[model samples]
Target chain A: MAKMNLLQAINSALDLAMAKHDNVYSFGEDTGGFGGVFRATSGLTEKYGKHRNFNTPLVEQGIIGFANGLASQGSYAVAEIQFGDYIFPAFDQIVNETAKFRYRSGNEFNVGGLTIRTPYGGGIAGGHYHSQSPEAYFAHTPGIKIVTPRNPYEAKGLLLSAIFEKNPVLFMEPKRLYRASTGEVPEEEYTIPLGKADVVKEGNDITVLGWGAQMEVTEKAVEKAEEDGVSCEVIDLRTISPWDVETVTQSVLKTGRLVISQEAPITGGFASEIAATVQDKCFLYLESPIARVSGIDVPYPLCHEKEYMADHLKIYEAIKRSMNY
Target chain B: MAKDKKHNTEIVTKPKWFDKDSVTIPMLQILKEDGSFHKDADMPAYDKELIVKIHDTMQFIRILDERMIAAQRQGRISFYLASRGEEAASVASAAALDFGDMIMGQYREQGALAYRGFTVEQFMNQLFSNEKDLGKGRQMPVHYGCADLNFMTISSPLGTQIPQATGYAFGQKMDKTENCTICYFGEGAASEGDFHAALNMASVYKVPVIFFCRNNGYAISTPAQGEQYGGDGIAPRGIGYGMKTIRIDGNDAFAVLKATQEARRLAVEENEPVLIEAMSYRMSGHSTSDDPTGYRTREEEAEWQAKDPLDRLQKWMMNEGWLDKDHVEEHHAEVKAKVLAALKESEKVPVPHIDELINDVYDEPTDMLKEQLDELKDHMRKYPDTYSKTSGRLD
Candidate 1:
């Protein structure tokens, strides 16, 4: 095992997958020799040879289309979208072609060997274009698995599992935690089962649920809530689609209250989905209504990043509200 | 942006408008109208088996289009798109490639699919959306795909496969397979952003992909002349991207075969992407939903009907003693009968079970999918009149 950041762990996972399978290819804008804008694919071109790992023209739709076509040939395509915000250009390909490739063809053709990796969430102060969490948009799309990781260990495990999952997967990496989040990761290959939620901390008063960078924020909020004589259970939802309902509902049933947070807008945010589902399952068991502490339904602001974000303070306030009710 | 090289050739003393019509790319027409070749034309070097296959696929497409249009009239299928006049543009080009090469065709390229060995039964099953259909009744009629045959599925969205072909060919190059890929789309589809994105990327990446643009006169209701582009067709776009480009008489089967053969050579031998613009006409309406009288003139349709690709190919083959009138008649009759039989047999087969509805959403249905399926089934059971009458599987 080695101590690595989220980016390193992701790179290690790509390296491991490419090493294990020659058919595994990784490419995108600036993802080749430059190792991506975030260097998430560093050293891959040299290690795997430029043929398999190379740069593509700066067209997001082209990248996804190319990846889909290659994956249709029974190859593993690991396509990187430069930024989650830029992935909109490829939205039709993902929602229509990639997701429906298997379903539309009745399993005769599939891009199941394809994994689309994009960095999501806001923290770098990169403004609108770079800082955005688009996971909610894809989570609503069926036929594709959506996975996000909170830390280094989870990043490596979930990413490996996505590549081998036999269904097109959208792996959203929390760019905000690329370097800020680090931990010991096993060098030996491993896979974390998708659609499973990991309970970071056990508590009985209230459940704080989030994924990716929000996991850390929720953990901090749980600490703040503890000071207020409230015990909160923290859950990291690794897979957004096919999310672990049993684990989350069980957690909500035990705590009798739930607060979900995300960087995306609250209106159609993934947090809203979780909050709605929790209320439906634990309706009679609830002491307070489900609270969604997420970003406002506006463009992500560059200057007011702290205020716009559902930071620990905002989540802490929401947890206190859930407890007060 | 295209004038930097002009400055190097000569200093501009006075401002002048560039004449777009100054350059005209000639269409490659080896086979002339009356069953003979142009004076200096060379016969395309193809095995007799391949020539026969291309001819047979064209005949198959002609029969399929005619009967399927009648089928649509009878309300047997929801929709159909006929490759009416652009047969050689699709089939001959398909005949030039190896079976390992990938074919990403638009909806009208059933000729190419047939050339790649898609059977009449498979075509009928897809059109009927029966249980035996490879698409599992998921897509509408005319959307066909066979991965085993290296033919990517037909998609409704125009030009989405253009960039996809570049990526697929890039994989072929990476695998060192000594193969190439062919992407087909119409002049109307060229207006899509994917067309520009695909051309620029294929050229920049130097992937072995042939972008075959069937410059059929209309894109549904939009004419290609002033609507699609102002410049000389899609051929110049290829030159602008610094790749080999060719324009061919799409109705001339020999020209299409020769152009594609040369393009494949450049692709597989040198890893160079090539673009071939085949000039043809959409003799029929875009799909069954359209009516040509709404947008085009009868005189215009008559002009292209005279250049019917099937008739031209038959004339050339007969003049060369490669075909007999009796054999050709027998072949057409056989194709019609076989297509009708397949249509009758396939439509009688039941549609896929209701369980298949949620099967390929993923390798295994998720909990959400399973729960949703249960809810749907209960809802269907409650309201059987609307579904069971047509599907006959609610119970």
Candidate 2:
């Protein structure tokens, strides 16, 4: 095991995936020479030839379309879309082409080898465009996997799993944790099964579920909740889509309360999806209605993003409200 | 068939293969590295008065970039993007335009804004995100927008401004205004679909607009050569769209001035859209947060430094006897002091008031926005030390 930052773990994961699979090819906008703006694919171009890992024009739709075709032809394609906010341009390509490629072809052809990586969420002072958490938009789309990692350790494992899995995956890396979150990650090859949840801490009173950067917020708020004589179980739902409902339902069965948190708007966020599913599964067991703490339903504010974000304090308030109820 | 912008659209007796080489656009280079021009090359405007102002502004910008980069390192500012090597590309081109014309910039066109009389104090106010800032500290540092100057607010998303520029120019056309619009972007932006859409629409609609492509060698880390595009740099695409296209030496102030002046004439008088590809290099990293040593070599940077746009313009001005060497030295010192003074003042100012958070959501804050704002205010009050205004801390 090696202590690595989130970005380093991600880079190590990409390096291992490319090294193990000869057919693996990584390409995207500004991803060559210098390893992209974030340097996630830094040494890939030099180690693998430019033909395998290279840069594409600054067109999101074109990059994903080309990646879908490449992966369909039996090549393991890993594509990067500079930022998650910029991924909207390629929405139709992802929703219509990448997601439906398998079922539409009736097992004749599929882009199951495709993995699109993009940095997402706020806390970097990225202002309007750079700070959006776009997981909710992709989460609603069927047939594609949406996976996010809580920290460095999870980042390395989940990314590898996404790449090797026989399905198209949208791997959203938390930019806020790219360097801030560090942990002991195995240097050797390993894969964490997708659609599974990791129980960070076990308790009896209440269960708090969050993913990606929101995991930190949940843990911090849980700490505060524990201080207030409340026992809280924390769970990181790594795979957002086709999420690990079994683990979450079991946690809620033991702890009769639930709080879901996310950086996106609460109205239609992935957190809402979790809340809806958990309520149905633990109807009689649940002592109180599940609460969701998320961003306001508006475009992310720049200067007042601190006021706009779904921080630990908000989560703490939700935990208190649920505990009282 | 008649010859248009490109070589004879002649009928071919037999089909033959044609490569990208057949339509190569030669780069227009007028000034040499040492401030002297090529044998027959001359400055475009030849206006001695405007020349002095251009050189002064360039020197001020060069100094401002140097100081602000150091300031960012010292944590005096959040971020900074320098217009270092390509100052002349923005400044000289702006020198050729009328202030009435609109400018839509994709970040890193501070030279254009500086040329349009955006003061150092104004720049620092925006950088520091003080109450004095016109944007109310809403945008990131270097994302300056001045409606008064007709310079549209910068959009961070690449190439989004390309199609917007076309629509803006179309509006100007409908009003029958003599003014046109100029949009600035890098060659990497040319790869976006918006670039193609903008060019096609502008040509078909016959709007007056100038599409300036700063063909800097790198887009953050991606180089322009075989990576960004396989064909020749952005100029060839303009030809494909049936628009007037020219490639110029962005480092040479003279070439930029000449090309822009001519493009402006075409745009304003003939209602023609012109595309100019200025070949230069990003002498610095993409931003203060970036480290260029990772992707680019020291030798490559040294080579571009030798072709520094500011040095070439200063040399030409000195050679023409329009500027004195001693005065240039004192002027540099003066600009350095001026920028440092502005930095000091901007840093001392407080950030925009807390109410600014929910004010601009609409003309009047909606009931929901007001409720959210009240909740945030209550949270901040509950954890005063947790969320500080002076220092943005979530801990």
Candidate 3:
């Protein structure tokens, strides 16, 4: 086991996957010599050679389109978009071509061996163009798997699994936790199956569900709720689509109350899906309505960035309301 | 006007670097519209059997387009996109390529699919979206693909296949194979950003890909002349990207065949990208949904009709003494009958089973998908008369 940050763990995972398979390749802007802007792919080109790890032009559409073609022709491609906010340029390629390749061809063709990685979420003060969390947009798209890991352990396991899975996966890394979050990640080959949520803390007062950077805030809020004598259960939903509804429903059924937290805008956010599902499944045992603590419905602004973001205070307040009701 | 503060330059006489007006790339035409070989142009020596096969495929496609369009008008099929005016560009290009080479087409290359042995029955199954359709009724009519044929499925979005072809060719290059990829698009699709990106990447990586642009005169109702570009058509864009390029007469089968043959040699042998612009006209409406009278006149259509590719190929075949006029007429009648029979037979087949709707979304339907499918089936059971396919059967 090695104590590594999210960036180091991701780099290690890429090295392991490339060393294991000759057809696996990784590429993006500045991913070769510069080791990527965040250095998530640091030292890969030197270790695997340029053919297997290289850089591409600063065009997102071309990068994804090229990955689709490469994956279709029996190669494993790991393409990185510099940031989540910039992924819209490749949205059509992902949603239309990559997601529909298998269904559209009726099993004649599929780009199942492709994985697209991008840094997402706020706390880096990247303004509207850099910090936007667009996971909700892709959660609505079928066929492609969406995963966001909370720490180095989840990062390495989920990424390795995504590379080997027989379907396209959108792996969104919370840029805020790249260096802040550290954990003991096993160096051996490992994989955490997608659509499974981990129960970080067990309690019976209320269940708090979150993922990505919001998990840290939820953890702090759970601690605060414990101090107030309101026991809170915390769950990190690793995968967005095909989410672990069974685990969440089980937790909510036990607690009879739920608080969903996310950094995305409140309206039409992924939290709404969880809340609706929980309400439908655990309605008879509910002590109160599901509460959502999320970012306000506004573009992430440069000034007053904290006001636009969801933090521990807001999560604590929502937990108190759920417990009080 | 304000004068610059820091600069005084002399107007030294220097040779002009480029002139858009004089940089016209001439179109190659070996066989003229009059069915005679151009005296100065060299003829491509294809085997007599291959030539007959190409002509036969073209004849079949011509009949298929006519009957399908009429069917759409009669409301038998929902939609159709005909390859009416550019049959030579599509069929002759496919003829020059090896069967193993990949083909990525932009909708109107039905002739290429026909050339690669996609049968009339397969076409009917896809058109009717029947249970036997390979795509499982996912895509609309004319969006065809076959894994056995090495053809990527057609996408409706313009120019998306351009970069995809370049990347697929890169994969072929990595495999160190003698095969390459041919991407077909229209001149109008060239205006998209992906076109430039694909050409630049193909040139920079020196991948083996043939970017075949069918400059078929219009993008829907927009003509190619004043609105498409400010310079010579898509050929110069290829040259500007530092790749080999050729412009050819799309109505002349001999020119398209020879040009593509040479381009394929450069691509596969030298690991170089090549672009060929085939100048033709869309002899029909943009699609069954369009009407030519809205954007063009009958006289203009008549002018292009004089240069029909099918007529040129037939005249050349007759001149070679390989086919007689009576035999050509009889062949068309037989193909028409076969297509009609296939259409009727395919439409009678049932639509794909409801389970297919959620099956291919992943390797296997997840529990979530199964639940959703069950919910849908339950809803259908309640409102049986709303759906035609499931009205009688609930289980």
Candidate 4:
């Protein structure tokens, strides 16, 4: 095992997938010789040749549509949308075509082997365009899987699984954690099943749930609560759609309290879905009303981003309120 | 306005490199509307049997369009789109390609499907959305697809298929196969951003694709003259992309066939992308919901009706001693009768089973999907009388 950052783990996963499967290829704007804007695909062009790994024209729609076409013909396409903010131009392709390909064709045709990788979430001072958590938009769509990894080890395993999934997947990498979070990743290839939640810490007082960069915020909050003699169980929901409801519900049932955190706005965020599910499933075991610590419902501000972010203080406050109740 | 001294040193002069008004690419017309050929134009190498097959397919499509439009008027079907006047652009281009070549169509290319041997029965099943329909009633009528024929399903989005075609052809190139892809779109769809993106990618990559634009005068109700663009139609845009482009008389079957044949050769042999802008007209309303009279005069409709591709082909066949006027009328009547019979038979078939609604969402339905489907079935069972289709046996 070797300590690797999230970007290195992602590159290793692509290398492993392409080495094992000749049909696998990658394309996106600025993804070729320049690696990527984040260097998530560095040196893939030299190793695999341009036929498999190449830079595409700077058109998100074209990139996604081309990937869909390639996947329809029995090829595994791993496409990158440079940033999550620029993904709206390709929304029609993903929602109308990629998500609906199998359903409309009645299994006679499908683009099942497509993986779209994009870096998202705030906390990097990237301003509005470069720092958006658009996972909820894709989670609402059926026939597509959505996953967000918390650290490098999880990133490698989840990305490998997403590539092998027999349906389109939106693999959202938390850009803030690309280099900030490091963990020992396996030297050999491995996969962690999607839709599974990882319990970072187990306790009986209250349950704190989060994912992506928010997981780091959640850890700090849990540490602070522990200092005050508050025992909390922290969970990172590795996948959004087809989420591990059983894990969260089971933990909430044992803990008798719940606090959800996210970087997206509070209204209609992925946190809302988790809160609703936990409340519905663990209503009888409740000790407090379900609480959410999330960004305010506004555009991500540049200057006052710290105030806008769901920082550790907000998470800590939500945990204290839930524990008190 | 003041210019910087460094920039002011370079003088500005008008360059005559290209003319905006001039039609740089001439339209190829082997057969005129009156069945006369240009003396200098070489006839396409089409045999009598193939010519008759193309003619019959065009006539079948024309009759099918007329009958389906009437059916919509009588409230038999929900909607219909007629490829009324652009038969040559669809059938002849399809005739020019090999069976292995891929076809990614917009809405109005049923003639290509018919040319690829999509039967009258198959057409009716799709229109009626019966259990036998290949698409399993997932799409609206006329949104057709056939995997067996290498024809991608027709998506309702305007120009999404253009970029998809380029990518599919890139796959074909990677496989080193002799096949190429032909993508069909109207002049209106060409205005979409995907169209430009796809064309630029195809040219940059030198992918094997033939971009077939059916400039059928109007995109729904907007005329191609002032509303579409200020340039000389869509061919010059292809030239601007450094693609081998040609403009042809879409009503003349021979011209379309010849152009597509050459385009396919260039695409397969040289890994080059080609664009063919076929000039034609939409003789009918855009769809059953549209009334062309609201936008254009009946006189204009009549003018396009005179240039009907089927009529031009019929006249040419008659001049070549392949078909007479009475024979053509009898053939039309026979096609009408066959289509009417198929429509009646297809409508009697049951709708797709309710379980089909949840079948293809994934390789296998997840546990959650199965639970939801079961709940739906239970609800339908309790209200069986309200769900008419539930009376039939479900898979």
Candidate 5:
């Protein structure tokens, strides 16, 4: 086992996946000699040569299209969109082509070995341009899978799974947590199955559900709640698309209350989906209405960074509000 | 990876740099514009039955377009895009390819799908957005996909399918299949970043894919002259990407077939990517929702009408003694009847079962999806009058 940052873990996963399969290649804007904006593909082109890893025109649609081409060839492709916010240009490729290939083709043709890597979320004050949680848009799209990680260990494992999965995987890396989030990860190859959640802390009063950078805030909130003599169980939902409803439901059933937290806007966010699910499946056990602590419905605001952002303090207040009844 | 500067210059050689024959492939014609054959020029000598069959399909598609456009105007449908002047580009190209070869199409290639045996009923079913529709009303009209026919569904975003075709063609090569994927887009779509990316990858990997561009003079209101940069059209960009390239009169069905045939030979046998630029015109509005009179003059439309692809094909049939006025009128009437009946039936059919909305996403719907489905069902049950049209058995 070794300790590494999310960026290094992601780079190692790419290197391992590419070195293991000659058909595996990578490319994006600055993904070649520059090793990507985040250096997730650092040293890949130098070692694998340009045929496998290279830089491309500053076009997101092209990068995705090229990746789709490689994937169709039975080649595993790990493509990067400079940032998550810019991926909308390639939305046609992801939502229209990549997502519907199997269903449209009557299961005759599908892209099982493709992964799109992008950095998402806004804790680093990336402003509106660089920061976004667009996973909800893709998660709603069928035939595509979504996975985001909070720590290096989950990042490496989930990425490997994404690389090997038999469908298009939108892997959103938390840009703010690339270095802020670190943990011990095994050098040996392993994969964390998608559609599962991890319970970081055990308690009975309420289930504090969060993902990506928001997991850190939820942990802080749990600590503060503990100091207030309010025990809370914190669950890190690593995969947001095929979210681990089983884990979340079981926790909700036991805790009898839920405080769903995410950095995305509260309206139409992942939190809303989870809240609706808790209301349906565990309503009988609920002591209070499910609460959501999230960014406002407004777009990731550039003018009031601290005021609109979700953090431990906001999470604590929401939890208190849910417990008031 | 090495940028071939000389090769690039050679591809961009202006038409002024070459004689007419050097630039334009001699169009394959069974008849002249006056409905008479040249005695000396070599002909492929297609059988009478096959010639009539091709004519029948073309006439049927033309009639279908007329009715569908009328339906859209009547507000029975949301939108419609017609092949209009470019039917030959689509129909003849489809006839040339093997059924197993994949097709990734833009909105205008319904002629290709119709020629490939996509039933008129299936077309109406999808267009009317009914239960029989393969997409189950999930998509807007013209976004057709048929798995059994190997035509990938049409996407709305311009040029997005270009790279996807490359990827799917690569998969065919990997499977050691003789099939190739044909992606059809307009010259307007060629300017998109995806087009450049798709061609670059297809050339680099030598994927068995054909990038078919219908360089139809305009992208809606923008004329090809100012909107795109290829002096000769989209063909040069294919060469720039190191792929095999060809240009042809898209209105000539024979030319489209010949170009696509040779392109298929390279893609299937040589694992090469080929780009075929079909010089054609968009005679109708970009969509039923558009008004082309705002941008183009009647003179421009009249000029293209003189080169009408349907008339040219009919002339060729007449010269071959394959079709006459009576036969043409009868075939036209028969196709109209078929389209009208299909449209009536399709509009009457119900939408897909409500449960179908949540099915096929996973082996089993996730608990969350199930929960959501339940909530929707409960909401419907509670408000039966509100959802009376859709609250039926789930498929």
Candidate 6:
């Protein structure tokens, strides 16, 4: 085992997947020698040569659409969308074709064995252009799996799982945590099952659930609750779509309270989904109504990064509200 | 249909329809104007049953277009896109392929889906966005995907399917499946960068893929005359890609089937990619949401209707005694009953279960997804009076 960051784990997974499968190739804007703007694909071109890892045009539509074609033919493709904000151009390809290819053609043509890696979520003052939490859009879609990792260990495990899975996957990486987050990741091959949540810190008072970058914020909130003589269980939801309701429900049932957090807007945010699930599954056990800590229902503010984020203070406040109820 | 000369608009003249240019392939027409077979034509042999099948499918498609469009107007369905005058192109090309071959179609190629034996019930279920839709009522109407049929779901965006088809064909080549992927798109989609990349990749790798272009005169409001490249419709570009290419009379079933069958042979057996350009007309609005009267003329529509592919095929079938007038009427009635019954069932089908929204993306639902599903359940419970029926099924 070795300690790694989100960026390191992602690169390692790509390297391993490419090495293991000859048909696994990758392409996107500046993914070749430049190794992507974040270097997630850094050193891949040098390692596997340009044929397997190369740069594509500046067109996102072309990149994903081409990946759809390549993946359809039995090639395992991991296409990069430069930033989550710019992925809209390729949304049609993902939502219309790649996601539903299996079910629409009655499983006649499926791109299930493909992965789309893109950086998303807000925190590094990227404003509206570079930062966004668009996973909900994909999570709303069927046929495609959506996953995001909070730490290096989960990153490596989930990436491996996504590579080998027999369905298309939207692998979102929180750019703000690429180098900031780290954990001990195994050196050899291993995979974490998708649709599972890890209880990072267990307590009896309440359950704090979040994913991607917000999971760290959620941990801070739990810590504050602990300092305030309030015990809280914090769970990191590593994947978004097909998320783990069983763990959350079980935790909430024991705690009798829940607080959901996300960096996306409050309305129709991923948190809403979680809140709904908790109410249904553990309604009888609940001592308090579910509380959500989310970004304002407005475009990410350019000058107010701290305010726009569902940071420690907000999560703490949400938890306090849920506990009081 | 005679080429319009009154406009005298020679935007870019490289190759006229019938002229021989190594750079530009002519529209392969097996049946001459007099309805006689052409000499030196490598056409597909069509027995009486196959001809009737092709004609029946076309007639059913036309009826489907009428009924569905009317249903949309009546608010029975959300939206629809008709195959209309392009029936021959889609049906003929689809008929030419092996049963196992893959079909990647744009939204307008309903005829191809129908030809693949996609039942009227399936079409209605998808159009009605009901629970029975294989898509689980997740997609907008007209975006049909059938897993068992091997017909890739129709995507609304113009050219996304081009590269997807290429990638799928690459898989076929790897598996040694001897099955080629035929991607159907309008000439306008040729302008998209995906089209260029797919062609380049398929050519370089020599993947088993057929790039089928239905040049139906217009892509929405943009006509093919100006919207497509200057040389000649879209055939020369195929030649420029260094792949075998052919242009065919889109209204002539014999020509389209002949060209497509040969293209599939080269694609599957030889691992060679090919492009087939079907010259046709858009006899209806691009879709239910569009109003073609704004850009096109009735005179133009009338002239194109005179060259109706179904009528010509019917003439041939009737002349050959393959189908009688009474049989045609009976077939129409039978297809109508099926389409109507499917429509009624689809309209009554409920939306997919709420829990299904979180399923299928992974082996099991993740914590975040669980949370979301929980939230929805809470909303439904909170508004208990609003969700009494829906909530009861939670168990």
Among the numbered candidates, top TM-score falls to: 2
Please give the lDDT score for candidate 3. 0.87
Q: Evaluated with lDDT, which candidate comes out highest?
A: 2
| Cα error, candidate 5, residue B135 (Å) | 1.7
Query: For candidate 5, lDDT tens digit of each residue in A1-325?
Result: 8889999999888888887889888887657655766678878878999788876654678778878877877889888887898788899999998999889989887887889999998865454556788888998898888998888998999999999999889999999898887889888788999878999888999899998888888888889888988889999998888888999999999999899888887668888888888899998899998888776554453323444467777788778877787
lDDT of 1 by residue, A1-325 (tens): 8999999999999999999999999998657665776789889988999788876654577789999999999999999987888788799999999999988888899999999999988876544556789888888889999999999999999999999999999999998899999899999789999999999999999989998889988888889889989988999999999899999999999989999988887778888888788788899999998988777655554433444577787788789888988
Indicate whether candidate 3 or candidate 6 has the larger DockQ.
6
Where model 1 places Cα greater than 4 Å from the true spot, the runs are A1-325, B1-17, B389-395
**B-chain TM-score, every candidate?**
0.95, 0.94, 0.95, 0.94, 0.89, 0.90
**Could you tell me the TM-score of candidate 6?**
0.57
> What DockQ does each candidate score versus the true complex, computed on alpha carbons?
0.02, 0.65, 0.02, 0.02, 0.03, 0.03
Winner on DockQ between 3 and 5 is 5
Looking at candidate 1, what TM-score does chain B attain? 0.95
Model 5 alpha-carbon drift over 4 Å, by segment:
A1-87, A90-325, B1-45, B392-395
Model 4 lDDT per residue over B87-118, tens place: 99999999999999999999899999999999
Q: If both were scored by DockQ, which would come out higher, candidate 1 or candidate 5?
A: 5
User: Which regions of candidate 6 fall more than 4 Å away from where they truly are?
Assistant: A1-325, B1-22, B32-36, B384-392
Candidate 3, residue B134: how far the Cα is off, in Å = 0.7
Task: Give candidate 2's error at residue A315 in angstroms.
Answer: 1.5
DockQ-based class of model 1: incorrect
TM-score of chain A of each: 0.99, 0.98, 0.99, 0.99, 0.97, 0.98
Docking class of 5: incorrect
